[model samples]
Target: MESNKSGFEPKNIWIARRKKQLRSAIIDLLNQYHEVPKEWIDEYNNHTIMSGSIIDTIIIIKESSTNCYEVQFGNGKSGSIVYSELDYEFQLFEATSEVEQVILCRNKVGLTKDKSFVQTMIDWLTSIGFIVDVDNGLRQTT
Candidate 1:
């Protein structure tokens, strides 16, 4: 017989006051910059690639709202709706990949694919005065 064992230790490297200062600084930085990274916009502009529009695919975390908003997954590049073997919508993998690359291009971009990421994003957005409804993911996704 064997018993499960766990080893974990919490470490505090910074003083509470110093941590507060650093946290304030980060929040200030985030609040000041409220635009999608220009690198993505510029790159998208330079490339004439198509199949879907950014409006339909990009998960724009707009100001005052915290929803990873995106349109319904329908209509393939070939103008057909696809479904998985289990009767779920089969997202256009290639197109969705492109969208993810451009919108979630940055390390901070959280998405539905990762719940932790989405919750982290919600917290950050909330701190920045955005109304995040994480529970409404289905509504937002659709």
Candidate 2:
């Protein structure tokens, strides 16, 4: 066989920077407009969407004094919780997708699944924040 001149190697790109910018943008949107429940911040910070996947968006929330959370959106048509096969409580998928529509050659109207997953997640975390711990007084979800 002929001697190879150079080994196969992948090219480097500025994907991380772009992702960081996107993350910052989403965070700003949530922080400025979305009423994110504080309890979900930690979980949101600790979670991230798989790179190279068709992720719609990601948000970072501050759950507690020392915790941050990450909320990711996916390409699905609606919100669907994906559970782990091994552990029922272990969430594997929390992302949601925007909706689309088809016309019938006439006047048509449509609506996408209102980012309900995000609101629901915030609600759940907010509710969890009110839980009382027998040993540690009241504790947040983080």
TM-score of 1: 0.20
Residue 7 error for model 1, in Å? Answer: 37
| Candidate 1 C-alpha lDDT tens digits along 1-142 | 5543655322232333443453344345434533334343333322313313332212322222232233222122211112233432222222345443222222233234545433454444444432222223332432
What lDDT does candidate 1 reach at residue 53? 31
Per-model TM values vs. the true structure: 0.20, 0.28
Candidate 1 CA-lDDT value: 0.32
lDDT (Cα, tens digit) per residue for candidate 2, span 1-142: 7654687332323445554554555455454544344444333332334344344433333222221223333322222222222342213234333442222112112212663333434334333331111111112321
Judge candidate 1 at residue 28 and give its lDDT: 50
Model 1, residue 35: C-alpha shift (Å): 11
Lowest lDDT sum, 10 consecutive residues, model 1, at 73-82
- Highest TM-score: give the candidate number: 2
Off-target runs (Cα >4 Å) in candidate 1 are 1-14, 34-124, 127-142
